[model samples]
Target chain A: MAQGMEIRNLSAWYGSQQVLKEINLPVSPNQVTAIIGPSGCGKSTFVRTLNRLHEIIPGARVSGQVFLGEVDLYAPGVDPVSIRRRIGMVFQKPNPFPTMSIFENAAAGLRLNGVDKRRLAEQVEKSLKLAALWDEVSNRLGQSGAALSGGQQQRLCLARALAVSPEILLMDEPASALDPAATLKIEDLIRELKKEYTIIVVTHNMQQAARVADQTAFFLNGELVEYGPSSEIFTRPKDRRTEDYITGRFG
Target chain B: MLHSYPFRKLLNRAVTVLMLLAVVLALIPLFSILWHTFERGWPAISPTFFTHLPKPVGETGGGIANALAGTGLLILLASSIGVPFGLLVGIYLAEFNPGGLGTVVRFLNDVLTGIPSIVTGMFVYSLLVLTMGGFSALAGGVALGLIMIPTVTRSTEEMLKMVPTSLREASLALGATKTQTILRVVLPAAIPGILTGIMLAVARVAGETAPLLFTAFGNRFWSLRLDQPIAALPLQIFTYAISPYRDWQTQAWGAALVLVTLVLVLNIVARLVFHRDGR
Candidate 1:
């Protein structure tokens, strides 16, 4: 039942330093859209502004019109909390709630939304299964989240996001810190999740974008240079910048 | 390089020897105090030292049991008041960045930590003892609680600041409100450090004789009433140590041993708890 997202004429800044300048894009529902760029390219900031999280910093600001289906996310009286509930996020580093057990970390979002206590066990199990982490973690549900390996912790974070049943999932380089094996696992999980959720991933790995994304958008210096079907974007880019970055000439 | 190498090695050895000497010098007073307390206070220890009330001044065989009970009450009261207040101020400083107000509060807390214990006692005396028309356990606890606030606040702030920002972001990204993120993630992660602070504050105030000198004023009889004046270990030790009676001076040594042991045990327990939590 989730709808596509449409971002129009969006710009963002941290104090006087503009990070994202006049961006427009459309993300289809129930598909993976990968945003690729070098470091400091505003890829993370753009996604953060999508969920109104960029404003949390001391002097960060945004002027944007983001529509999730028919509702303008930045329109008057729109509560950022409510907007975020419908769009969950995962960060570059794996951060499972340090004090919570594996089971509790999965159930945190549900608990916050006042989900029934009796049903939490079932929900947590379902989320872990969806994240492909159940088999590894199910036996030791009471152990602290910190006890997990780096890769397992990232999957646990995925399970936590999925538990909330958000319409959209934003992953900011979810597998960047992981090993190749773990990275493949997350990529496979993303492929599976695209069936039920609209997903946007920000990554520095071109191969990862080629592997996981239905659509690919190339960014450089806070500007979106090209966005198209993954096949076209990789094989035949319209812009020189996109072509140059993709071809390993320069970043 | 060849010419300097031999001289550098000799210098390093000399420095190591000097550091070892410094360490031994620092440890001398610590070991000496422990030895003296154990030697002088050993005979005075008995079952009644912990279980019975203090005897009349000239009588030779009583204990500081009333003072022990009063100390327990005072610590409980002070901690109850100090912990929550300190934790909230620390949260404000760490989380809210309350601008100029936060700077003012931090400066004041540092100043409070520097103030003499007797001065804190006098302030409490003027504020509570004079206003309430008597020295009571409540006034003594208030003075100790005031002393506790600065240490607790500073430690809590430091602990909270140490919590990684990623955890807060993770919580917020999951649609948790700011308050929920802080309560569910930040505070829980910082618990070990905050608890260490609280334990240290409690230990710091436990041996304070000057603060209780004019506030609790000292009582001979067993009194549990918070409003009434109460006896405490430090007050009992100080009173007896200054008395002409040799038996009372002996009792003071016993009380000092008990007090030091209690504080040492508490610190050990706190360290154990924090270590376990950290893992």
Candidate 2:
């Protein structure tokens, strides 16, 4: 599992409006990297570009090199669907397939690939356990996933992504819609998930980034201001802008 | 009896009376039709009217069995074929295209919907009726189905459009393929709305008489074949109305009453479906 990613001079535009501009970063494998910036700073757009999902928007385009290992994801011959399969993502809010059963929710990816029943059952069980949701939901796998609580829905979404066995997980504020307890559980799950998968998280919560991320990247106006060990970035950032962000002076 | 300030109070009373009089004016036509139809129609409605075939122009005490069965079968055929195709086009316009193509398709559907029913019947008559060498139930069903398409398409699109963007974004974000997201997430949430659309389309097509007149020309016999002229309630009523026999005219009014009842029932069902979903 090659988990680290190298992005070079990435820029994104929505129609005539440019959101992300000239971003460069290298993320380490089996580590938690957090991108923290103010609202409308293009943090979400930057994260979505990693999984090639940003292009789903109309009149939206990305330019520059995004390399997942030696493969340039944006290369002319590269397939966006395959890239997405390998680099799975979760959104800020939980959105389970409302019509599907809880069991089916965790098995969507395998089913999409036309996997047989025996393998699908194995993947669903493994993914659910991996997300630490097996015990709470073991009895009612036949129930509609829309019936689950907000926190459980987020976990279900995580299990769904994990079922595909993706190498990299890009979450755009995964726990922002969750309550404090649910947020803590999700943050803890992220820490646990990073043991095997490369995790990239974008959040506005400075404290959250400090607590869970192994590395922190502070961005301003779509530019990377500073990237370093979490302790160093939060305690002693090299750039004055980074210091100002961590110290709550200004975004 | 008239005194000071009588002008102001009299004016207010006059407005109240005028409003009530307007309501009564509206009801008079409706009530008159209802009473007149029932008064003349009941004597024609008997077990024989449902079981036995209609008698000759001057005779009485027969049935409209063929017309009832024909109407039912034609509606079934038209709605079954038209509803599914309309739903697919609607989903495409809402989820898949959502661009210039979708816009053009929707505009065309709306334009087709606004076309008069008789024109649709006439067109189908000229095309299928002329080609097939005569009027047939198949021709009528084709025309009715054409009329149904626009209504189903418009309503289904409106319902599917009501689904929130966040729901779609969330599904896509989870690495779901576009097919999986639409089938599993979007369509299920929009099912009730789609059903209501189907009901509305059904009602619109069921009450259509002008289209069937040219396509399914009145047949006295209960014709089972789609390739031949067939019996329908509206066509039978037309046949009965022109006859010099008072009995035939009364039977026509009876068939008309039955047709109105079916449309009213369908409208109620459609409203109920919409109400359940809206709540």
TM-score for each model:
0.97, 0.88
Q: Write candidate 2's Cα lDDT for B1-279 as tens digits.
A: 766697879999999999999999999998888788778777777777787777766554788899988888788778877898898898899888678888788789989989999999999999999998999989988888889988888888888888887777766765567887788778888888788788777777876789998998868987868898888888888888887878888889888887777777877887787676453
TM-score of decoy 1: 0.97
User: What TM-score does the predicted chain A of each candidate obtain versus native chain A?
Assistant: 0.99, 0.98
Give the number of the best model, judged by lDDT: 1
Chain B TM-score for all candidates, comma-separated: 0.97, 0.85
Worst 10 residues of 1 chain A by lDDT: A1-10
Which digits, one per residue and each the tens of the lDDT, describe model 2 over residues A1-251?
54699989999999988888899999999999999998888999999889888898889999999988889999999977778888878889887877679998898777777889998998899999998889989999999888889999999989998998988999999999999999999999999999899999999999999999999998888788889999999998899988888888976
Clashing pairs in 2: B49-B63
The prediction achieving the highest DockQ against the true structure is: 1
Off by over 4 Å in 1: B1-3
- Give the TM-score (vs. native) of candidate 2: 0.88
